[model samples]
Target: MRTIAKLENVSKTYKLADDQQLEVLSQINLDVQEGEFIALLGQSGCGKSTILRIMSGLIKPTSGTAYQYDEKLQGINETISIVFQSFALYPWLTVYENVRIGLIKRQLSSSQEEQEITEAIRLIGLGGHENAYPKELSGGMRQRVGFARALVAKPEILAMDEPFSALDVLTAQNLRAEVIDLWKNKEGTFKSAFMVTHNISEAVSMASKIMILSSHPGRIVHVIENKMPYPRNEKSPAFLALVDEIHGLITTLNLPDTPKEHPISKAIFENAESKAFENIPYVQISRILGFLEVLKDDNGRTKIFELAAKMKEEFGSVISIAKAVEILNFIETPGQDVVLTELGRKFIEAESTNQKLIFRKQLVLMKLFRLIIDKLTTLKTLAEDDLKVEINNRFPYENADKMVDTIVDWGRYGEIFEFNADLKVFTQFEDSV
Candidate 1:
């Protein structure tokens, strides 16, 4: 692949007025190929915008160098167009004048300059509104004016900094589609475009490549190649798989602790049966768990109430305590917290909610099922952290988790006695179940 722009070990350090230096970017190396769409993604203060500014020639890199290739060997190259979140147009200038500003400055003749401005306005879907001023336009329309002005510059690289963040969802999505279409049609001519956004879905939809940066002296951490073809489907299994993979990578970076392992024993659920309840309410169940944690066991077997008080002391309230217990299944309330009744204690001791174990089992079962009955995995082991991760990864997809959850819920209700801990390794005796 031909690299059109390269940032070789670039670092940007800002020396404040008080002489306190802040190192924003450290040892950043990135390459953009000709005609490639790349997205820079990270939390705030990750130096994403700083990189864009450096690329636009508006700021200099504190250390190392950034280079852009000129294919035509043109006379010292030309300007790089930039679009910002602010839309940056002069309020006094009409949309037509704003779009014409860059071209006019290049000493172009009147007719040619007007034609360029007209074409750019038309290209960005603002053709008939050229005479409209920025103050009169909606957020989306004003952004289009900014886009038109940038396009009119005819820059070799188009760099945007959260340009659509201010618009409503539908409008931003529409504009994103338009931008992608513009890029595809102008392949070779447009050369390359770079965007910095915090939205994961935006990066997935628009870019050929997505680079994630780690915060605190921001540095590139992971580069994911989005191989799916456009237009991409946010719901497709392939899309979700990629999203989950990226999520897994990102999550691993933020938390380095080795998770507690709790594998399940098949004997815990040896007599499982499927039953569905349609009228379950999560809030009622959450309250029951909350109250249960506050109640002490009469037999000195450890009351959920004691658990609740401990949770409250550590985590703050009955609700959050109940929720945390819900995550770990230290207490089970299916739409209402019923007494532990022995089985609940059994499930908790088994640590049946470990997510990594569950995910690993799901992977294994998926491969096995595909090779056998074309069935989805049913057996899953999850811990507190895994449950949180699963909820995030499985959101808006398959809802397979509901079934895994049903299995756990059944175990909590004393319908089963098996506990599979740490990825289906064993079947242990449940003293309580």
Candidate 2:
């Protein structure tokens, strides 16, 4: 029970071009103990991966320090290895060469390198594919090569940033089981592993400790230990209970109306007082409408967590979609549950043309869309560059393009206006108001 990696009062901030600091992680004080599997679970953009990079000495925190085995980490060293979501393999190299590369600068004898590579591949269940190129292997096999490459180094700690995320469900499940088995029996070279994942069941099943991170300037809000024994049965009441409990915990946790003091991110986005260009990411309009239909089929009321589980989507993705629904005033999210508003029900019941009409009304009501409409009326043809510049003036420079693009998509899709992509201009269509 020795402390291996520690983050003491770590706060990381990225300076943006707008002279604004994007706070990544704040006051993160945590540690990894010997023989512990720690899962950092949170929404995307929560800076979970940033924590991994900081611990691995891949990046330095703006404030606080990262320690490896009681020593302040100077830089990336051989003591730790990371398996990334992407295979991170040289496509031209064979599996043997890829695994062998990790031991390149170690000054090991040729015999030593061969032995380590062979054993690492074998342990990761990639025994016979050593000579095959990465292009010849399946995604799962390539990831096993990634595992083998990280393992051949004999690191004290293993860090993975959504390593299994890109694989199929069954494949990810099998890999998780294998890794958990290795940890259960102390087969792998590492004393502990840190995994950044959003999979609730995966975190509950594998991690001896789970850290729940909050979005918008991420922070570790809770750290819980798993008391259940190994070989956790997903069908069992205990496993289900843990899943439900965590889901409830997350959905109930203070998901503030205002995300981190930003009025623009608030559920009630700026009113007439301010016209801050909103940065809400656009999920496909079809997906948004379909999501509402699913909710409607569920009687127009379902908890966000329940909807996420049913849709097999991440909480963050669903929440962002719900935010869009909120922006259009199509759904009433009084709390964790969403209720389809009368406008939403009407839109669903309407015919195609009527639906487009409703969508047009909703789009025109948006602050950005209204501003665009105003510009089009004044200029006759609003250049996309001018629209982006207007957005940048109101919001962060980073989100300007995304914000403007989303606005343009809604404009064209809703039939509120026409967009000439080649000319990068917004023009009034025959149906435009």
Candidate with the greatest TM-score versus the true structure: 2
Clash numbers, per candidate = 30, 0
TM-score of each: 0.58, 0.85
Write down the worst ten-residue block by lDDT for model 2. Answer: 254-263
Clashing pairs in 2: none
Q: Across residues 8-119, which tens digit of lDDT does each residue of candidate 1 receive?
A: 7889877642233556788898877777899998755568998887766667888877776633222222546788999898999999988887675478888889888888
How many Å off is the CA of 21 in candidate 2? 5.8
Off by over 4 Å in 1: 70-79, 187-189, 258-433
Worst 10 residues of 1 by lDDT: 272-281
Candidate 2 TM-score, true structure as reference: 0.85
The segments of candidate 2 whose C-alpha lies over 4 angstroms from its true place after superposition are 9-27, 62-64, 252-272, 275-279, 334-336, 375-398, 417-433
lDDT of each: 0.60, 0.82
What is the per-residue lDDT of model 2 for residues 39-142, given as tens digits with 9 covering 90 to 100? Answer: 99887778999999999999999999999888988887456789999999998899999999889767799898988889998899997898999999999999
Best by lDDT: 2
